[model samples]
Target chain A: MTDEQRRRRGRPRSEQAHDAVLAAARELLAEVGYARLTIEGVAARAGVGKTTIYRWWSSKAELVAEILYRPISIEEIPESGSPRDDLAANIRLIVEPFTDPWYGPALTGARNDLNADPEGQKAFQAQIMSGRRDTGRAVFQRLVDAGDLPPDTDVDYLIDVMSGLLVYRGAIWRQPITEEDVRKLVALLVDGRPPRRTPS
Target chain B: MTDEQRRRRGRPRSEQAHDAVLAAARELLAEVGYARLTIEGVAARAGVGKTTIYRWWSSKAELVAEILYRPISIEEIPESGSPRDDLAANIRLIVEPFTDPWYGPALTGARNDLNADPEGQKAFQAQIMSGRRDTGRAVFQRLVDAGDLPPDTDVDYLIDVMSGLLVYRGAIWRQPITEEDVRKLVALLVDGRPPRRTPS
Candidate 1:
């Protein structure tokens, strides 16, 4: 192992403290939304000094970055061969997880902070948005290949519309993206008919 | 006039100070953006006491609320008898002005602040969103009346989709909702075909 890695692992207290801090952050994030979440509260709950949390993470946004990794990673996009089912699955993967009681508050709260931070925005673009875009590209590309979508479709713009709608609904509007909404979104964006209307 | 109004007008200095405070707030908002804007800064720029600003508007958000009134008021929606033409015009009304050098930055910057403020949020909804929703309702209701949309189409959801995409594009993602983008949006939401496909 590298010298820094060896030093970190050599002290059991440091490792235990790290895990405790993460756990405490998660719990408190769920309890108090991101606006009210404080390093002092996390330190108090984690039973570590404020300096301890500060020593590792410079800002609360940074701490939240670690705690709030993407719930649906790129590798998890369901490639179910049937493009329709896969597209619906992809939509669910993006939209459903944020509706979770624990993850939802953390994400929507941190999103505002991340938007204001230039460095955080870049990191989010790289880490979260790039994956999101790629997953969308895959879905759209498959649809094009399957003759379900026009070959000249603007994939990036379409992705923005779909995710923008879902995110705005789930995060800003605080509404559930119902099944009917999903079906309508898919139909409107894809071929303009509900699945039942299309001949088998 | 009411006694308080007569008293306020009686003091010419008070009227000038109010005008100066508002003008200073607008200048500073465009100069430094919402997050960096402060009551002290407004007072200094206006050559008034901080208490003067506090006396008029309770918070920076309240000041911003007055400064950042909706650009496209609901009454401005065109009723040109042509659904397609009117829909495109409606989209332009909602999405275009924010592209201006002055209003775009102020609106986007204050948007984050407004999201975080509950009282500000209420006023924003009452003043801004209600007007916006009404405009969309009018446009879509016309479309339904003209037999362009399905009889049972969910007007509210379509409004959300259109506004969500445009707001997320113009406000959050910091992209211009171009003419082409507007055309694509109108097509997807209203009917399957672009305007070209429908014979005049």
Candidate 2:
């Protein structure tokens, strides 16, 4: 509908090529794990030249991360009238990918493999983790501005607490997180359990 | 002294030898890394026979885990007649080994290495993680029993939330956790904000 769409010539070819490379990368990563994956292998499997891969991404880690991240980042947190609803929805949205049975394990294997690779670690921390925090911070800031959260709230710690709890349950325990768990956590963040004092 | 303490001649030698082996294992795990460390290396460093190392432990992973865990497990959360105090103390105690500049990183590296070792994973979950849950459960049970927390409180999820947040900050961020952070988390768990009500 736009001028770019009407005039675009090489765009479709590039889009098709990008999709091919990503599909190949995903398949190869699942089959061989992250450490064994090579750009050459992905390029060959995707039937695209190695230069096609490098044109978009500088390194293998970058390519893998780019391939893995959804078009919509965690920044697009869902919003409802109430803070509680928005928070719960936000948690599920972010957590869904990491806990996915098939995709999740593959991504985790890639992440664990990055532990020793300084370049991979830097990219992961910079691109993935940093993006997560910034997105969540923006969402929390909106909530605070809308008067849903208190003005005095420490948004940084709050984000850490919420994400940390979710990661702990999902990644470490490998447990199936329940709807009830999410509800209670968001509820706890909003309302604390005041200790009972002596009868007055 | 008890009869067992007084009557054992070989027990004393074995105890001395056990201490030496553990000390050496701890030292090496710090200097090198889990992947490069071996039982034979630990034995030589401890000035003991390989059989001495094998007498009590079955594998290198088991040996490392044993050498690391203190007699007082994390489940033995402290009590101070208050949920706030108890929770703060519990967080510090559990997080101590992970954040220690020397002892902690080595243990963590060993844990990371356990990803490839199914035996090590099981041992860690059963001996360490389970123990943490049980110990914290007993502590929370006391709090609930005393009516500090609501009887319907989900203790299991609560434990996960607390520990998960602490781990996310300490292990992942590698940030310095302050006393204030611990206190605030415990306070949040204790006192939730009252839900807003519509005016009649």
True interface contacts reproduced, per candidate: 0.23, 0.44
Interface root-mean-square deviation (Å) of every model: 5.3, 7.2
What lDDT is reached at residue A49 by model 2? 97
Task: Give the per-residue lDDT digits (tens) of candidate 2, residues B10-40.
Answer: 4678898998998898888878866578999
Please give the DockQ score of every candidate, comma-separated: 0.21, 0.35
Off by over 4 Å in 1: A1-24, A38-58, A62-71, A100-112, A193-200, B1-24, B39-58, B62-71, B100-119, B193-200
Per-residue lDDT of candidate 1, residues B4-97 (tens digit): 9998778888788998998898898778877788999999999999998888776787787667654455467667878877878888877765
What are the lDDT scores of the predictions, listed in order? Answer: 0.73, 0.69
lDDT of 2 at A118: 59
What clash pairs does model 1 have?
A: none
Docking class of 2: acceptable
Whole-structure CA lDDT of model 1: 0.73
**lDDT leader:** 1
- Residue A77 lDDT in candidate 2: 62
Q: List the residue pairs that clash in candidate 2.
A: A191-B192, A191-B193, A192-B191, A192-B192, A193-B190, A193-B191, B75-B135
